[model samples]
Target: MNDLPAFLLRKADEYNAPSFIPADPICVPHSFSKKQDIEIAGFFAAIFAWGNRTTIIGKTKELMALMGNSPHNFILHHKEKERERLLGFKHRTFTATDLLWFVQVLQQHYQRYDSLETAFFPTPVKAQEHAVKHGLIRLQQTFFSTPGAPMRTRKHLSSPERNSGCKRLNMFLRWMVRHDNSGVDFGLWKNIAPADLIMPIDLHVARVAKRFGLMERKLPDWQAAEELTAYFRTIDPEDPVRFDFALFGLGVLEKF
Candidate 1:
């Protein structure tokens, strides 16, 4: 495995390009330039990213259209009656009910803060290890903090506290925090360093990590995600999760 780092670097460079965007859910957010729009759009895209890539992109685009393609503005200013446009929307198990709650939470959040980064950090502090873990925990708490928050919607947002890998949320963080000239990841938020970002583990990432001897956990839980991220950090301490492009592309696109 001495050459594994070089192999990963090559693969990461191969896939982390603008060409990688069109067929993936990341395209949903790439369609927008506003920071909040990207955050809101990317959040939905990541959350809806299951089953099939085409379906995920389609559903996310439909959601954005329902919001009149100005997600941040729509979430902040749309009337209660305007929400009816989202009535029949459904992506896999995510229903209109879930979307409404999401809108409510986002509206409440954006009303107070200009960006979604604060929802994760809530305060300015120097970058620290385990920042993403704490941020995920805090986000789950704040998401469900509203009075009478639906129990059904809780399934949509996973937390490390629940032993979930929080794949979708971690993926969203990757979209928001990973900075590069590659133009794939947005790098819109600076509070969390890319180094501290945990690997967003799904079946694809898990399979690739195991094949490359990066992880051993049988279950792809939060521990497995952390284990894989820890391994990558050994190779590139400052920007470990950049290897995600390699692992995910190998598993999903190359079927390795």
Candidate 2:
């Protein structure tokens, strides 16, 4: 409707090419075929998707190797001796303790639900705004509810209720939920509508959004993610988060 929307659409098209997948953490999940493997790999990759991109990919590969490149199987049935291989793994502040706890939680979760989506949105979806926010809250609760979960590991799994931007989790959601002819996104989860997805507002995206008059918030928090996603919806109600590539690309690649 507006020039801003059109311009962003153009940028999204420019950036959302098939070739972009290889350089991203999403590639880790893409390399796997099984649904559970994809979910497990993507979740691990996303949680560690901070700091440098090269470092992120490297660590993700290392972690995957430790899992024997079979993430779901590894998480569900890792022997005690096999888990010792993960003892020295560390990505930023996410250390071996956090990784082991995640495996434990995933085991508990898979025992109950068929997919991770159910663990997040266990209740029926009512007609409501911020249902995704509610899902994230429930997911946090479920994650920490695992037996012997250390309070220290809670920071890795963000809570939107706490005003966190939750950039990485939202990015993982994008990888799982948004599909296009371009094939960058997976569109694996059918329960969550694409319209409900929010922008993963990292620093690069936030800077680009501000430069384009898409956001006024100084902090890239939950409020900023909502504001930015609402603005993007005006441009494309069916898939507002498509513009996430545009925002992130404009900032990171074009240096806008």
Candidate 3:
């Protein structure tokens, strides 16, 4: 237990290989080249990234197909008739209505910005505490800022204001921000720093964190994410979320 961070670091190195990308929702973004395409694909994939991993990957691929496998182009220029393909799409609580609102809001957002990072971090990403969490809240405010956005769509996005862990958005930020030789994370964003990123606390990560004595919180809420990230930051403040691969692989793959 004393050497837990070292062991987790080893596991992170072991599991963060290029080979791990194919079976992951991250693959949806890796399939594309353009930055906008990667960002768009990764955003939708992260939103659908709950429940069974296999099912998540499958449904995400279906979503890409609906966008004609060109997410940025589809979001910007798809004709009204083409949106019919998004009908009947369902993944857990994310229904067709939710998807439709996302498309519309994203389309509206892209009208002014070239990437989701700009939409999320409209202001300069200062080195303030809870900057990432504040950005998530701002993203929600901006997403629903315009008219015609369904109230239900707001439920799909999480915010620190609601005390949500915001696992999906944090994970999406990891995909966009964390840069490493490891081929898993896309590292496409330049605004947000990896140091400011929060942990994406789900059941698996929570279980591993508690077992390793890294987390004391009873529930995987926003507070737990902060506590866990704080611990990891003590060890590696500049790139704490890389421990995500270790916790995920240990919990889901190795049963640690």
TM-score of each candidate structure, all chains considered together: 0.97, 0.96, 0.97
Ranking by TM-score: 1, 3, 2
Please write out the lDDT profile of model 3 over residues 1-256, one tens digit for every residue: 7787798889888988998898889988899999999999899889999988889889999999989898999999988899999998999989999998899888988888888898777666767888898889889988888887898888889898999999999999999999999879988887778999998999999998888888888889999999999988988989999999999999888888
Question: Which wins on TM-score, candidate 1 or candidate 2?
Answer: 1
Residue-pair clashes per prediction, in order, are 0, 0, 0
For model 2 the TM-score comes to 0.96
Which candidate do you rate higher for TM-score, 1 or 3? 1
Task: Evaluate all candidate structures by whole-model CA lDDT and list the values in order.
Answer: 0.91, 0.86, 0.89
Q: Per-residue alpha-carbon lDDT of model 1 for 95-115, expressed as tens digits?
A: 988999999999999999999
Clashing pairs in 1: none
Count: clashes, candidate 2: 0
lDDT of 2 by residue, 60-150 (tens): 9899998899888887777788889999999989989898888888887887777888876665565468978988998898888766888
Model 2, position 27: C-alpha lDDT score:
84
Q: Which 10-residue span in candidate 3 carries the lowest summed lDDT?
A: 118-127
Of the candidates numbered 1 and 3, which has the greater lDDT value?
Answer: 1
